[model samples]
Every structure is written in structure tokens, then in C-alpha cells.
Target chain A: MQLRQLSLRPFRNFARIDLEFAEGGAVIVGANGRGKSNILEAICYQSIGKSIRGARDHEAVPHGEGHFDIRGDWQQGQRRHPCRVFYGADDGKRVFLDEAPLPRVSDLVSHFQTVYFAPQDVALVLQFSAQRRRLLDIVLSQADAVYLKALQTYQRLLTQRNHFLRSLGHRGVDPTEREVWDAQLAKPGALLRHHRLLGLVEIMPDFARQYDVFSTGQETAGLLYADEVIESNPDEIPTRDQLEATFRQQLRDGFEKERHAGHTLNGPHRDGFVFTIDGEAADAFGSQGQQKSVLLSWKMAELRLLERRKGQQPLLLLDDVFSELDPIRSAHLIEMVEDFDQVILTAPRQPQESLGDRYARIDLE
Target chain B: MGPEPLEDLVVAFTRLPGIGRKTAQRLALYVLKSPPQEAESLAAAVRAARENIGHCTRCFHLTERGQELCHICRDPRRDTGMICVVEEASDALALERSELMRGTYHVLGGALSPLDGVGPEDLRIAELVERVREEGIREVILAHNASAEGEATAEYIHQRLDGMTQVSRLARGLPAGSDLDLADRTTLAHALQGRVQF
Candidate 1:
């Protein structure tokens, strides 16, 4: 999907601006604090229905302003969709596809797809397991609606089950309620584990190929879904029933342990995603550059999966990340990115690498 | 400024569900401009309804004051062996409107939601269990909504009533007259899962 025109009203630092994007998309060059990233954030906010920077809706509204509105026309092949998102202090957020109002914000996710890459995404590999899980979740959620629904259901059940477990620490909570929550949670939990495992399995081959492209194929890279219930066999996908049984058994056996912890101690919520280089853990054995390579490969693999699943090339939003990469990686990244129809890039200044003339350049003061 | 009583009246209107301050003020002004008899009749009707309505002893459904059993429970022709359990009194009424079930109804006050501090003891689960035991119920059809809390409540009740009587839940699928293309993926998936052999 490609954005044709974007108009932001009182959003972030921009009081008002209208951008007409080219077929190759545009690069916004500016000094720091000139809202270059904010433009990317506004574009991403339309796709995901919230700030990718994790800012609240009210925060996007400028100081002394009561509301913000973003309007854009997105093109996918021959069809063009007019999208509008309006947020008010009084009326909350409303999204429209074409001219009709979307009943739910989640409905808008599949309408527009974006793969947002920023400089901080390097933390996906070096930081906590949650970051990797979130990346996997975002990719999978945008690609598959069933996975998104299951994820929402799993999160809700996990919250309720944890709340009930906490109440078990005190009096007046029925012990049998544990069985109720277990039965309720097992289906979605197993589904989440299944999808996460399948996602890694499907993406691992491309992930390794992308890593080889970046690393000169010297060492073999691998992705692992570190799950206790289902064996991570890339050759064979685990059935949801297999996952559900093991999940139920784990919940039963770990009840006492969970009670001691005052919350859930098992299931996919605690599952680990590990990146391995030459059969060794990458975070422990690899250098910082190697970690960033793994992250980049994983993101490219995500983009491929999105394209394969949705049958559309997702809009790639690159935010101030080109300058952070070394010359070799940046050159290779540019080579890979040139194949895409639309690419939105931001930088502190025009990068040394000359992006081809297909990219429309815009400078902000 | 209007008098304190008018402000108090607006406040009272706002106390009701889904009434905002603006809506409350509008209602207060509308009431003020209306005839005196209209306000008196409205007040008398609210007072009479509050005084006359009470819950049935068995099902917890709204019944006339001093009634032991609701009209459904008192009907001799209705099947006493099967009880359709629902999450709310309104749910029971909805199922009754379908005219499909010949059994009596059991209205659980609400579903079990521990996060909201609602437990089995807070709902009418114990009463339903007692009725199933003492009233010779053969089957309890669980008509709870298809929400997590509702499913948990149904499972809990099924556990409690294990081996004593058969328990079942309502079949969920596409709404009547809804086109298959219009069904959301989740609903379509559910309908596929619950599809019957024709």
C-alpha cells in the first residue's frame, strides 16, 4: 500500500501541512526536533490507530489545541481508499475508511499496513524478550486477523486469571475458579503459542537468507521459539490441540507454583524468542553489529511475510535510521529498499549515500 | 441562575445510567416546562414501579410484589424438568421472545468476573443449584453470552452441577437474516465450528 496525499492538522509539532507523495515516496530531511519523526509517527498512527512512539492521542494534539485530524488517500493497485482519523478531547478518536466511519479501531489495522523501522529497534535483539515478542505480535497481528483476535482474547483472559490468582492470596475466592480460568485461557494461549511458533518457523528461512545477505554467509543464523509445550520443529507445525493439551497440563502442574508467585508463571506470555548464531545464543556470543544485523534481517523477513500473507507491498517507514548504519550496511539496505514501490525515509541531514532520483526529497527547517 | 431544587433535579437525572450533565439539564428543563400533572404522573409511576416490583424467589426475575414465583414458574403447562439459565433477567426475556423453549428460566444476576469483584456467591449460582436439586430439574440449558466471563460462569456452574443433571449451552452462530458475506471472521469461524450436519 502507498500513501498518495497526507494532511495533518494540529498534529505533533506541525500546525498544518499537506504532503503529496510520489510513486517512490519521499524522504524528509531536517535537523533534530523539526518533527521529521513526528511525520512518520503520524503516518504510522493512521495505520495502527495509535502513536507508534507510544504517545497518547491527547499528546498528539498540540498545546492549547483540543483536537487533531489526519487525512490521507492510500492506493493499492487500482483502488484508492480515502482515510481520515479525527481525535477530540470531547469525542475521543474516530476513524473513517472511504467516507464511512469504522465501527472499531481494530478494523482499521488490516486496511492499511506499514512496517515501521527506527534506530531504537536495535533493542529488539539486545534488550528484553518482550521487545521481540511485541515485534512478532505486531507483524502477526497486522498480517492475520485471527491471530489478532486470539491475541486480544489471550491477553484479556490472562489479566482475569492473574486477577483471580491474586485474589487467591486472600480469602473469599473459590479454588474451582482456577479450573474455569484454565479452561477459558487454554484455547487462546495455545493458539498464541501455535501462531508464534508457526510465524518463526515460516520466517526463519528468509531470516537466515537475509542474514547471509548482510553477513557474507560466513556463519549460519537461526531463529528459535523457546516454548516448553510445543516442540519447535520447523519441518512440522504443531497442531493447536497438541499445544492446548500441554498448556492445560502445565497450568495444572504449575498451579501451586503460580499461587506462590501470586500470578501466572507459565504459558505463552512467558515464552522466549531466541536468536542463534552458529548454534550459539546471539546476544551472548555475537557483537553489537551482529545483533543489529539479526534485527534487520528479522524485520526484512517480517516484511516478506506481510507481503506474502496480505498480497500487497506494505508501506516502509524508515525513521532516521539510515545515518545510524555503517556504510556497507546502509548500501546493502538501500539496494534492498530500492526494489520497493514506496519508501518513506527520514534523516538528520541528507545522507552520504545518494538515494536514487526515484525518491522525492523534502527538506524541513 | 435557577433554584437549588432545579440543580438538584438535574443532578438526580444525571445519576441515572447513560445520562450526562447536558442530557440531565435538558431533561430537567423539559420537565420544568411540562404540565404539573405530567411531572406528578411520572413521579407517581416511578414510585409505584419501585414499590410493586420484586424478584421471584426461585429465578431472581422481576415479579409483582409479594409473589413467590414468577409467571413463567407458576405456569402449569411449562416444562419444569428443563431450566434455561441466563446471565440477566433481560436475557431470559430475549430467549422467551424466540418462543422456542418450553422450559422455565433461571436468571443469574450476572456472569462471574473476578476482576470486577463478581464471584459465584455474588450471582444466583447457589440458588440455581438448589433449584436444580430440589425442583427435579433434568437439564439446565446455559444461555450465557459468549464472553470470557460468561463462558467461565457456565463452566463453573457445569462443574457444580456435575453428574446431578445434564448441562448444555446455547448454540452461537450468525444472526438470523445476516448474509454470510457480512459476518465477521470471528463469527464466521464460530459458525463453522458449531455447524450442524444437515
Candidate 2:
């Protein structure tokens, strides 16, 4: 999907701004604090239906303003879609596609595919498991609708089960109730883990190869799905029935532990993906530059995965990460920019290298 | 603020489901502009309903204050041997609108939602069990909403009544008139899973 035009109102530092994108996407350049990142944020929000920086909806509203509105004209193949997202303090958030309101915010997923890369995303390799889990969720949610629905169901059931456990006072509750909850949870939990492991499996080779290209070949890269419910080898994507059976068994076996902890102790919620370099945990052994390389390679693999699954080039948003990259990684990003259908990147100063004839430059004051 | 009575009316309207502040204000204004007797009648209806309506002795459905049974329970033509269980009286009413079911209903008042502090004790599950055993019901149809909590409630009831009598859940699939394209992906998947022989 390509973002043809974008308009923002009362969004963060930009009270109002409108820009028409070029065929190859535009490079937004401005000094620090000039709202260069806000442009990319607006475009990302229009695609993903929320603040990409993890800010709450109201936080994006300008000072003393009650709401923020983002409008984008997107193109895919021969079809053009006009999308609008409006959030108000009183009415909450609403999204529209072709002038018809979507029933849920999640309905916006996969409609306009985008892959966003920011400096903070390096945390995917060097930070807590939640970041990597979120990366999996974002990529899968954008590539497959069923994955998004299953993910939403799994998260909600996890919360409800946790609350139910807390309400039980940690013991002596009837086992049938737990059985009911386990049966309810295992169905969606299995779907979540099945897709997660499948995604990791599909992206592993690409991830490994891209990491080698981005870094010295002396080290080998590996991705492993760390699951709590079912034990599987790195290459084995278990069937849904096997996953469900194992999930139910784990929940039954972990009842006492979960009851003691006052929450659920097993399921996809507690699962994660482990990135390793040279057969060692990258988060613990890799240097800062190595971690950046890991994240960059993972992102490139994610782009490929999305393209293969979506059958089209997804909009790539690079948020001012060029200065942080070495020449090698920067060269890789520029090559990716050329390969992609649209790329909107924000930088403090324009890179010296050319981005071909179709790329446009926008300077913000 | 406007007049205290008008504000009070708006607040009361706002307490109703799906009524926001703007909708409540509009409803209050409409009530104020209507004839005084119309307002009096609405108030009287609400008061009378609250005062007179009570749970049926056996099924927990709304009935007259002093009545021992609801109209369906009192009807001799209805099949007392079969009972349909539901989460709320409104659901029972929706089922009754079809004019297809000939059995009586047992309203559980609500489903089991431990997150909301609702449990088996909070609902009329024990009473349902008691009626099934004492009344010699042949089949119990679990007609609760198709939600996680509702399914859990059904599971709980099914376990409680295990081996006591035959039990079945309502068939879940696409609506009759809805096109296959109109159904959501989850619903479509469910319909596929629950598909039967042609």
C-alpha cells in the first residue's frame, strides 16, 4: 500500500499540516523539535489506528485541544481508499474507510500495510520479552486478519482468567470452573502460538541471512520461539490440535502455581521469542551495535514476510534512524528504500546519497 | 447547570444503556416538551413495573408480584418436560418472539463472569438444577449468548447436571439471511467448524 496524501489536524506539535506524497514517497527533513517525526507518526497512525510511540490517544491531541484527526489517501493496485481517524476527548476514537465507520479499531488492521522502524526498536533485541512479543503481534496482525482476531481473543481471555483467579482467593475454588476457563482459553491460545511459531519459522532463514549481511559473518544468528505450553523444536510448527491439547494439559498441571501467584502462569501470554547470536542469547551477549544489527535484520525479514504474505509492497516508515546507523547499515536501508513501493523517512538533515528520481524531499520549519 | 429537575431527568436518562450525555439531554428535552400526562404515564409505568414484577417461583422469569408462576409456566399447552436456559429475561423474550419453541424457559438472571464477581451462586443455577431433578425435565436447551462467559456458564451448568438428563446447546452459525461475505471471519470459521451434512 502507498500513502498518496496525508493531512493532520491538532496532532501533537503540528496544529495542522497537509502534504501530498510523491510516487516513491518523501524524505521529511527538519531540525530537532520541528515535528518531523510527527508526520511519520500521523501516517503510521492512519495505517495502524493508534499512536506508534505507545502514547495514549489523548496524548496526541495538541495543547488545549479536544481531539486529533488524521486523513490519508492510500492506493493499492488500482483501488484508492480514503481513510480517516478521529479521536475526541468526549466521543473516543472512531475510524472510517471510504466514509463508512469501522465497527472496531482492530478492523483497520491489514487494510493499509506499513512497517515502521525507529531508533527505539533496537530494544527488540536488548529489552524485555514484551517488546519482541509486540513485534510479532504487529507483523502478524498486519499480515493476517485471523491472527489479529485470535490475538485479541487470547489477550482478553488471559485478563479474564487472571481476574477470575484473583477473585478465588488463591485456593479451594471448584476445579470444574477452572476446567471451563481452560477449555475456553485453550482454543484461542493454540491459534496464537501456532501462528507465532509459524511466523518465526518462516522468517528464521531470512533473519539469519540478513543479520550476516548486516554484521560480520563470524557470528551466526538464530531465532527460537520460547513457549511455556508446548515443547517443540525450532523448526516444528505444531498442529492446532497438538497445541490445544498441550495448552489444556499445561493449564491443568499449573493450576496450583497459578492459584498461588493469583494469575495465569502458562499460555501464549507468557511465551516469547529469543534472539541468539553464535548460539548465545543476543540480549545478554551482543554489544549495542550487534543488537542494532539484529533488530535491523529482523525488520528487513519482517518486511519480506509481509510482502510475501500480503502480495504487495507495504508502506515503509523510517523515523530518523539514519544518523544512528553506520555506513553499512545505512547502505542497506537505502537499498531497501529503492526496493520498496513507498518509504517515508524522517531525518535531521538529508542524506548525501541520492534516493532515485521519484523520491521527493520535504523540509519542515 | 440548568434547572435541578431537568438535570435530574438527564442524569436518570444517562443511567440507561447506550444513552450518552447528549442523548440523555435530548431525551430529557423531549420529555419536558411532551404533554404532562404523557410524562406521568411513563413514570407510572416504570413504578408499576418495578413494584409488580417478580421472579417466577420455579424459573426466575418476571411475573406478577403475588403470582407463583409466569404465563408460560401457567400455560397447559407448553411442554413442561423441556426447559430452555438463558442468561437474561430479554434473551428469553427474543427466543419467544420466534414462535417456534414450545418449551418453558429458566432465566439464570445472568451468566457466570468471575471477573465481574458473578458466580454460580450469583445466578439461579442451583434452582435450575433443582427444577431439572424434581420436574423430570427431559431435555434442557442452553440458549445463553455466544460469549466466553456464556459458554463458561453453560459448561458449569452442564457439569452440575451431568447424567441427570439430556442437555444440548443452541446451534451457532451464520444468520439466516446474511450473505457469506457479510459474516465476520471468526463467525465464518465457526460456521465451517459447525457445518453439518447436507
Segments in model 1 whose C-alpha atoms lie over 4 Å from true places = A172-175, A227-233, A279-285, B1-4
Per-residue lDDT for B37-139 in model 1, tens only?
9999999999999999999988888899988889898889999999999999899889889898899998999988878978788898889889989999999
Q: For model 1, what is the error of residue A27's alpha carbon versus the real structure, in angstroms, after optimal superposition?
A: 1.1
Q: Summing lDDT over every window of 10 consecutive residues in candidate 1 chain A, give the lowest-scoring window.
A: A226-235
Model 2: per-residue Cα lDDT over B1-198, one tens digit each: 799999999999999999999999999999999999999999999999999999899888889999999989999999999999999999988999999989999999998887787867789988999999999999999998877788789988999899999999988889998899868887888899999999
How high is the TM-score of chain A in each model? Answer: 0.93, 0.95
- List clash counts for every candidate, in order: 0, 0
**What are the DockQ scores of the candidates, in order?**
0.74, 0.72
Provide the lowest-lDDT 10-residue window in model 1 chain B: B112-121
lDDT tens per residue, model 1, A111-134: 788988885557543577876777
Residue B137 CA displacement from its true place in model 1, Å: 2.0
Residue A111, model 2, lDDT: 85
Q: What's the residue-level lDDT of B112 in candidate 1?
A: 85
